[model samples]
Target: MGKFIDLTAADGFVFPAYVAEPAGKPKAAVVVLQEIFGVNSHIQQVTDRFAAQGYLAVAPATFHRVKPGVDMGYDEAGMKEGIALKAAVNGLPAPGVLTDIQAAIDHAAKASGGKVGIIGFCWGGFLAWRAACLLKGLSAAVPYYGGGMTAPAEIALQPKCPVLAHFSDRDH
Candidate 1:
């Protein structure tokens, strides 16, 4: 249900994204942000699910700038590696991975000709929250277990779009 496409950011950085299109006309578009493990199979499946539900879904490889083709499993080693990668992205200059998300949102809105929304998990959730606050062309945001997003600074930033945050009671 999905395929890879290259999107160029405002900084002329091109990255790959997993895109899933619905069978008929789409009601809207959704940007599915990947977890810390990058846009792996699970993320692609989520995008496909969104496409199945009549939305054009795009999951960008947010880790591409730091490490391309990351597809780590849910193991201790993977967690450590993913954490390191996320930290690297965090240490990047201002507007690091956010630009990639903006590119995906812009593509989704243009391709589907409708409003765009974002949803993410884990580290991606934090990025999604930032996108809602800093990016353009987003109508709504949903961050599931957004790590590091509850800080006072992050919470104080006004979001440009409405946001729905889902947190697990047992989250680390």
Candidate 2:
């Protein structure tokens, strides 16, 4: 239902992305951002689910710059390692990953004929919001449990598209 593909960023950085195509003609395209764990099996499943819903889906490996092919479990050690990796990537320059995200969005728009949306979880959730604000040509955004997106300054970056955000009361 899905396969891995390559995408080039604005900076000419090439990275891998997981793509799931709908069985029939697509109604839209969705750019699925991954958690801090990278484009793992769970993310792939999500992409497949979106594809099953009649949308072309893609999930770019946002951690490629710092650590390529990162797929970890949801155990405590995985969380610690994922947090560390997230911190490491966070230390890099602004919008580096965003460029790759834009590449994904561009692919999605082309695939769906300009009707594109983005959805993400955890760290990817924050990125989904950021992508909404920073990237162009998005029709909508759905961010689930974006932990670090509560900052006023960050939220001030208005989205170019409609956003549907989901949060857990226990999430910080």
> How high is each candidate's TM-score?
0.97, 0.96
Stretches of candidate 2 off by over 4 Å are none
Candidate 1 lDDT by residue in tens digits, 53-140: 9999999999999998899887888889999999999999988999899999999999999999999998888888999999999999
Model 2: per-residue lDDT, tens digit, 57-170? 999999898888899888888788889988887888987789999999999889778599999999999999999989998999999999878898887788899999998876
Worst 10 residues of 2 by lDDT: 163-172
Cα error of candidate 2 at position 56, Å:
0.3
Candidate 1 local distance difference test against the native: 0.93
RMSD list, candidates in order: 1.0, 1.3
Whole-model lDDT values for every prediction: 0.93, 0.91
Best by TM-score: 1
